[model samples]
Target chain A: MAKYSKFAAVGLLLAFPLLVSSDYYRHIMILALMWVVIGSSWNLLAGYTGQISFGHAIFFGVGAYSAGLCTTKLGISAWWGMLIGGPMAMLFGFVLGAICFRLRGTYFNLATLALAEILRLVAKSWVSLTEGMMGILTIQTFRSKVPYYYLAFGIAALCVFAIWAIIRSKWGYYFVAIREDQDAAEHLGISAFRYKSISLLVSSFFTGVAGAFYMNYMGFIDPDVVFSLYYISIMAILVAIIGGAGMIWGPPVGAFIMVLLQELFRSAFFGYLPKWISEAHAMAFGILVIVVIRFMANGVVGDWVKLSGLFTRQKAPIPSVTSGN
Target chain B: MEMFIQMLVAGILIGGIYALIGLGMTLIMGVMRIINLAHGQLMMVAMYITYVLYFYLGIDPYFALLVAMPALFLLGVAIQKYFLNPLLKIDSIIPQNQILMTVGVGIVLTETIRFIFRSDYKSVKTSYSSATFMIGNISWNVPMFVAFGLAVALTAGLFIFLLKTDAGKSVRATAQNKDAAMIMGINADWITQLTYGLGAAMAAAGGTLLLPIYYLFPDVGSQFTLKAFIITVLGGMGSTVGAIVGGIVLGIAETLGATYISMDLKDAFGMVIFVVVLVFMPGGLKELTKV
Candidate 1:
């Protein structure tokens, strides 16, 4: 039954484009799928490896710029970004890990954040290379949303599958061990730093791919859009946290919920509600983050049993507090 | 040489204000062992409060500090007591949930202010907003100089409170060791809340001081929040003395960077220095002074 449910879910996703003809819903799904990849990558590093990064935007923007630069500099199809973006992101990840992994806890988080800010500034100021704030624009291939949707779906699946394989492997144990207690893991002969770097490499690779995909899908790239600290970095954290950090299905579930909620609020319930509610979308996300962290720290997938328990009461009756006698 | 002196003077004056912001962050970090990402948003809230007082009632931004500081203290206390304090019990995978929560709170704060004031840049145009004074070859903005004096006085007051008072000692005790502080009858929870409140008040004071010279907007908090953390890290996490030194150093570095380097990359210099400090001088100035 469990296997059937999993297959059923996959089948539903595979057939989603065929089932839904509207571009609006399809666009939202593509975004949700992209987030799934990004969120899962973040979860691999922060959730599993215990090195919480406050700057996934650095990798994201790098992936995006790699794709954008391919078109302008190389004059090749932006589709080529899919091939190089992940590797480029991984290269950045290696350097970032070398610098940040030496530090622990808050220091690591801060370094990543500072680096992301630096990248944003560089992307903004380096006019000769990046065209500065003018941003890189490209003509997207394939007008239909189906191709993009399938591409997003494939990447998300590949990301999730790769992460699942890694987690089940011996390296997964090392990652978990490092997360639980780096010192204890070291005592057992596991090199914490090496495993952490591996985790980051795979994580950033998938995130970079997502970034490249975004460039292709959106057909435009800007430092503010891609490298935004609040929108990209923080949003990734929110997706992972809201869905359940350590669980495999967490980010996928989180991505869908977050993307849907954002669209719902952004459109003000498909324009049925007042326009003022549209402005409150960011605030809605803020409130959602607070509520989720406060109440559902384990997220939707991690706390499935608890969530289900709320709806389906137990058959066992409670004993009377006072004795009948 | 003249430009250098002018930049130094400007940096030092701004650094004094920055120190107040950093002091609050350092205090919260010391007590909670968590980075309060909302520190700048709290300051922004205070700035808005001051703006309201100044624009509507004709209250001076300096005098409005009295209202802004107390109000922010309450807001900070409420946040710590209600929102943050509860998280201590909720078992979760991420130990950084509190920090994440602060990010959320910061967003809500910024968006709420945005909803109320809109995104238009607002500034308190006091008579002294553009006034300047000359001391030999170097000139200092009048509002900035006055702000620097007030900031110094506030720092002195905070130092006295920290060094001389019972509550202040309890805060230090809690920061050092929560369990030990509890055993020593220090009510660690109350101290945590008090420290947060005090931190918020300090940030509020900084925002109020900066109002006359600096522009105000809803998103202004995030910029200062970054600046505050940079100062905190530069000062050697959780060290008040370190925060002061870090603030001044950062101010000077930023001023010089803006003057000499591309103005567009002014913010990058502080971040670069922050990363360098994290890598090489992890203990910040605190390690040098051994404070």
Candidate 2:
């Protein structure tokens, strides 16, 4: 029954664009799908590997700029960004890992954050190369939201599947072992550093691809939007945490909910409510973060039994299997 | 040579205020063992309080400091007692829950201020705001000098408190080892709240001092938040003395970067230093000074 529900959920997502003719809803779905890729990647590193990065925006922005540069500097179809962006992001990730992997826990988090900020400053100031804050404007290939939605869906699906596969493999065990205890993992002959870097590399690649897709779909790229600490990096963390950080399906679930919640607030409950509520959308995100962290740190999916148990007095049936599996 | 000295003086003046901000963050970091990402937002709240008192109530910004500091102290105690303290009991996979909570608090604070004040940049103008004194070739702004003096006095006062007072000793004990402090009959929970309050009060003082020279806006808190953390890391995580030196180094580097390099990349200099220090000297200046 659970398996059937999972299939039904995927089917609903695939058919969502066809069901929703409104470009606005489709646009929201597309953005949600992009976040799925980014969030899942982050989940791989921080949730699975225990390397909490506050700098996912570094990969994201680097991937975006690579794509943007392909058009302006290299004079190729931005579609080549789809090919090059991931690898470019991976290369930078390797270097970042080399420098930052030495630090553990909060230090690693801050290092990544500082690196992302530095990248933003670089992108903003390197006007001749990045066109500075003027931003990059490219003609999006397709005018309809349908193509973008499908593309985002395909990429998100691919990313989710890839992460699911990685977690099921030996690498996934190593990642989890490291998360559980880095010292123990090392004692067990797992090179914690190598596995952590591998996790980061895979995580960064998908995030970069998502950033590239964002550039193509949005038809714009800027330092502020692409490399934002609050919007991109923190948003990635929020999505992963809100959905269920360690769970395979958590990020995608989180992405959809967050995107929908944001859209609902941004559109002032689909224009049913007053306009001023839309301006408070960011505040809503902040509040959601606090409430979620406070009450649902394991996330809705991770704490499904506990959360459902709250509404009903009846004891929730104890599942034979844990969600961690 | 003249340009160098002028920049040095400017850096030192700004560094004094930076030290105050760093001191607050380091205090929180020491006790809680979590970076208070909301440190600058707290300062921003205090600055707004000062701005309101000045703009509407006809109080001088300097006089507003007394009101803002205590208000912020109470606000900090409430946050620590209510928001952060509650999270310690919740079981979660992530060890950084408190840090993430601080981020949420910062965003909420910034957005709330934005909702109330809008995003318009506001500044207080005092007679001393533009006043400057000349020492040979270097010019020192009068307000900057006064702010610097106040920062030094506060630092001295803090050192006295931390070194001499029982409450201060308990706070230090809690920071050093929570369990040991608890065993020593210190109310670790109360000490945590007190430390957070003291940290917020210090940040409030820093914000009030910066009012005359700096502009105010809801988003301005984030810049200072980053600056505060950079100073904390540079000063060696929880070391008060280290924060002081780190602040000065960051100030000098920033001033030099603005003068010699592009002014736009001045902020980047601190980040660059942060990364370098993290990689090469993780213990920061505190590790070197061994104080």
Candidate 3:
């Protein structure tokens, strides 16, 4: 029955574009698909590998920039970005991992954050290559949202499948072992550094591809949009955590929820609410993050049993202190 | 040579305020073992408080320091008591929940300030803001000089408090080892809250000092947050003395970069130094000082 439901879900997603005619909804779905790729990749590195990076935007921006550079500098079709962006991001990931993996915990996190900030600064100052804050604009290859929707769906599906495969493989166990106890894993003869680098490489590749796709679909690229700490990096973490980190289906679920909720707030409850509500959308996003972290740290998928139990069990029994006494 | 000296002087003066900010962060880092990503946002909140007092009440920015510091202290305590402390008990997949919580706190603080004040750049233009005094071949901005003097005084006061006071000793004890401190009848929880408050107050002092010379905006906190961490890393994490030296070094480096290199890359200089320090001298200036 579960397998059938999975198939049904995929079938629905495949037919979504045909069933939905509104370009706005389609656009939101496309963005959601893009986030699925990013969030899942982030989950692999952070949730599975135990390396919480605050700098996924580095890969995403690199991929987008690579694609953007292709059009501006190489005078090639942006479609070639689809081919080149992943490897380029992976190469950067290797360098970043080499530099940052030596540090543990908060130090590692800070190092990645520094790298992202450095990249953003470089992209901004290197106007000769990146065009600075003016941003890079290119003509979209296709006018209709339908083609982009399918492309995005294909990529998201491919990413999900690839992650699912990896998680089920021996490498998946190795990743989990490292996350659970890095020192113990190393003592057991697993090279923590090697597995971590592998996880980061795979994670960076998918994020890069998603970024390249974003450049193709959006037809505009800028350092701030791609490398933004809040919008891209934090948003990726939020999507994974909000849906459920460390769970196979978590990030995909989170991607849809985040994108839809953002749309709902951005549109001010679909224009039924006051226009000023739209201005507070970012605040709402911030509040959502706080709420999720505080109340649902394990996320909806990870804590499904607990959440359902809360609803079903109207009165939670208090433990009697008299027994211990 | 004259220009270089002038830049050095300016850097050292600004570095005094930077030290105050770094000291706060290092204190929090020492106790909590987590980098308070919201450190700058707390400073931002204090700056807004100072701005409000200066704008509406005609209070001097210097006088607003008292008001802002205590207000931030309370704010910091509340954040620790309510938002951060509760997470310690909850089991989560992400081990870095506290750090992430700080990030969320930062976003909320920035957005809330944006909601209330809007994003237009605001600054307090005191008569002394642009006032300068020339000595030899170099000149010193009057406000910056006053701020540096106050900063040094505050640092000295903090040292005395830490060394001589019972409460401050408890904080130090807790930071050294929570279990041992608790065994010695210290309320580790209370110490943590107090430490967070003290850290925020120090950051507030830094922000208030900067207000006379710097522009105030909701987003300004993030840049300062980055600077604070760079100083923390440069000084060696959790080392107060190291933070002071790190702050001065960063300030000089930035000033020199702005003067000799492109102004656009001024921020990058700190990052370059940070990476170099991380790779070569992970222990930071604290290792060299052995203090």
Candidate 4:
């Protein structure tokens, strides 16, 4: 029954491209799907492993910039740019993870966050290569959003499958066990550091791919726009909290709700209010986070799973059977 | 060479305010174990409170402290009792909910301030913004000295309050061990509320002190908060003296970096201290000093 539902869902997702019309709808779907991939991968390190990283944006920006830089300077294809993007982000992620994961808890969070800021600062000041504050404005853009949409959708689907595969494997069990209690997991012979490093690398790979997709789609890359603190906050908090973090669907759900509502919020309010008085969405975004976390901690889908009597409401069910498998 | 000394003085002075910024964050972390990312936003809010009173109401920025401090304290109490208290039940030290929720509060507060007072950078020029006092070979900006003095006073006052007052002691006790303190009749809830409120109030006061020197903006808090986090980490979380020393170190490093090196890379220098501290002396600079 579970296998049937899963296959049906994937099948429907595949068919989504044929059903959608108009560039606007496709644009939204593609961005949402790209978020789906990026968010899912993030969940592996942050959500599943219980090591909350506030700087996943670093990987994304690195991917976008690397891909952008390679394409522009070396005349590399987007395909080639993307090919290099993941490993670059992963390599950086590995270094950062290796250094910071040594710290116990709060220090680790602070370290990643600092690394993100440093990268942003570097990107901002590195005018010779990155074009500095004016940003890279002339990346190639296709008129139709269809190709980007398909690309994003394919990436998002790939991310989902990758995460699903990990979850079903022994590594996933270790990820869970380590997340739940690192000390206990270590006593049982799990090298918590190795697991975290691997997770960070994998997470960074997908994040960079998403970044490549973003620069290609937007055709612009700048520090403020691509690596803004608030954007990171929006996706990080939304995916992990709203979609029931530590699960597969968290980041995708977060991206969907955040992107859609934000679009509506921005568009509707843009012409409605005075230019100076029009910062309501920023306020609204915050209030909405508090409301969501205060109420639906298990997230929208997590809540639904509870309502449907499928998910047992405890601290995320430890896969006892999979632990020893 | 003379310019170097001047930059060094400026750096230490800047570090004073940075220490003030980290004071509340360190206290809260000691008690609550959450980094309070919105702390910088809180400083922004405090600056706005002072800005509105000074610009709109035509009140003195110093006088704005009277309104801002208590107001922010109440806000903190409400936040702690309502928003953050629930997350305390969770076992994780880095309570994800508190971090996210505070960020939300910061966004709302900043937007509200932006709505009321436009985004124009406002600084209180009380006939002393540009004033300087010269010594044998170097000069110090009067506003820098004053801001540093106030920051010192704030830290001193905080330490005194934590040590001397019964309530403050209870809050400290709660941070040490909530259950053990609760067994001795300390209301952990009350302490948490008081500590959070005190943290916000101190930030408000810090803003009042800072208004004369630093131009106020809705996002200015981000600048300080990042440094404060670095200060807190380098000093060790929950250590007031640590925050103070760490702030001074960061300030000096940033000033020298900005003067000697590229101005753009100034903030990076402070972060380098933070990174090095995190790597070498994870316990904090004090720990390394002890060894």
Candidate 1: CAPRI quality band: high
Residues B8-31 of candidate 3: C-alpha lDDT, one tens digit per residue: 999999999999999999999989
Instruction: Flag the better candidate by TM-score, 2 or 4.
Output: 2
Model 1 chain B is weakest, by summed lDDT over 10 consecutive residues, at: B131-140
Q: Tell me the tens digit of each residue's lDDT in model 3 across A252-282.
A: 9899999999999999999999999999898
Model 1, residue B235: distance off in Å is 0.7
Q: What does TM-score give for chain A of every model?
A: 0.95, 0.97, 0.95, 0.88
The digit string of per-residue lDDT tens for model 4 on B116-138 reads 77688778887888899899789
Better of 2 and 3 by TM-score: 2
Candidate 2, superposed: residue stretches over 4 Å from native:
A315-323
Q: Which whole-number lDDT from 0 to 100 does residue A231 have in model 2?
A: 88
Output the better candidate (2/4) by DockQ.
2
Runs in model 1 lying further than 4 Å from the true structure: A314-325
Worst ten in a row by lDDT for model 3 chain B: B275-284
Model 1, total clashes: 0
Give the proportion of true interface contacts each model preserves, from 0 to 1: 0.67, 0.61, 0.49, 0.58
Q: Which residue pairs show collisions in model 4?
A: none
lDDT of 2 by residue, A193-292 (tens): 8999999999999999998998899989999999999889999998988898988888888998888998899899999999999999999888887888
